[model samples]
Target: MPDTPLDLAHLRAFHAVVQAGGFSAAARRLHRTQSAVSHAVRKLETSAKVRLLDRRGREVRLTEAGRRLLSACDLAFATLDAAQEELGQERGRAEGRIRVGATVEFGCSVLMRHIQPFLAAHPGLEMDFHLGHDLLTPLLREEVDLAIDCHDHARADLERTPLFRESYMVACSPGYLASHAIREPEDLARCTVLSLDKAGAWWERFLARFPRTRRPAFGRVVAIDHIRALITAAASGMGVLLAPSYSLQEELARGELVPLFPSIRPHEDRFALYQKTARARLAKHRLLKAYLEALNPAELGA
Candidate 1:
């Protein structure tokens, strides 16, 4: 065999000549002169130390050595084409870590369920969820790829995608409901009410909706920082409290807590917040957007 290194041009010309069935057609397909195509085929044969063509009159055929070399060339070129195609797709498609920030209650109650299926569809992706008190600060600092929160503060650099609407529901233990004889929003004024310290805006909206009566007097008013503690207190008949419906689904199913008033639903809010810069560069943001789209209220029951 010749000591020259293999050249892709030579291999391509050889494959094209064999597949195209003649030098003239191969030259036209490759946009090269017939002589140049012939020269490339000759160089390829010399490197392999084999006779690659049998010329019978004006027609040309492949010799035994030529047939074997053509088969090897076919396999090699196919592999190279496949590798290039895959690399191109990786550069253009979405794949990478997406750090998401969410408040604790929203993260556990709603966001976590959607993540598993999203990861299943994209096994190459990784996610880091940062659950905390403040979602907007981390998002503004670009510490996370997306933020899911109830409050939508306007910022010139930030974009928002509204995921779903959720409403607050006043809940109390079955025992409390049975004992208190609370028939209307007015009756809640006489019952103890549990308050979540961090639910500032939500609490304000709740009060604004039910301004017909005075704030409830607490036999024992306890301000809790965590949602789970508030839920626990309501379940134990300690006080009536307001919380998101999604967070209270399990307890309601278990008969631990009953909705305070069937006729009146409290104030509701929509969650609409995303990073502005991230939304513009969609290749990196597609996965996060896809996950949020699946959380629409219509699909929640499914």
Candidate 2:
């Protein structure tokens, strides 16, 4: 047979099928019948002269050729979608989903407040928030459109922009502070230190800022994965815990916890992360970045 020519409809159908994982699902997505969808895929395979999918038990799997073609098709579709969004934006409209991943502390303290206003401003835009202990994994896996993280590591395929700076404060139950006679920063050395273990590097950076002799005495070090749990432990007077100021703002206002050694607080750098490929497609990512930038302490009232 003569070499078949490429067809956008065939490509679209194949992409829909691959993404939806079934002919019926793809048909529903494209508003076409299952037979029409199957015929489109057959035409695509005929054009390419290759089997694109394999039957694996009850599921359909992409053949190696299919996987490669699907990747290219995804990139092409993403570019087209981004271009369309840019045109819409130029015409005074914005659209598309913004998936954001954030650390627990940042999510509750900063992110939660801004989301409402952002949605109000962009009526049709969709937002998905994923709160995780680590921001890097989600960004790397394409699980989130963007991530707010505490530090930037060197990664050739990732791009990071410094968003803001925040300080760590040592806080403990008012009762604990009063009972322990901890009137100064140095007195913290005598108490247990509650730490969020997942905050590994950030926690170390915070500690590095302390003077050798004045560093808090390391007693029983308890590590938990969640920042809120650390805050809860500190509120119960179990130990002195270091955390971002915003995360414990409410507790501090309630007089449940007191900032330990305000003078010795350490500052941490905050960054926004996205894959280099995603960064190059800024029009697609700009709204999320703009939303986050507005939430920065200097921009927002904090």
Candidate 1 lDDT by residue in tens digits, 1-302 = 44887678998888777667678878887999999999998898888777788767556788998877766775575455445545645776446567888878878887786678777876666789999878876664345668877787777556677777877788899999889888876676678778876334435646666554664333445677788889998999887888887889999989999997766666777776576442434444655676676656422333
lDDT of 2: 0.74
Taking the tens digit of each residue's C-alpha lDDT, what string does model 2 give over 25-55? 7889799999999899998998899999886
Measured by lDDT, the strongest candidate is: 2
CA lDDT of each candidate? 0.73, 0.74
TM per prediction: 0.64, 0.71
What is the clash count for each candidate, in the order shown? 1, 1
- The numbered model that scores best in TM-score is 2
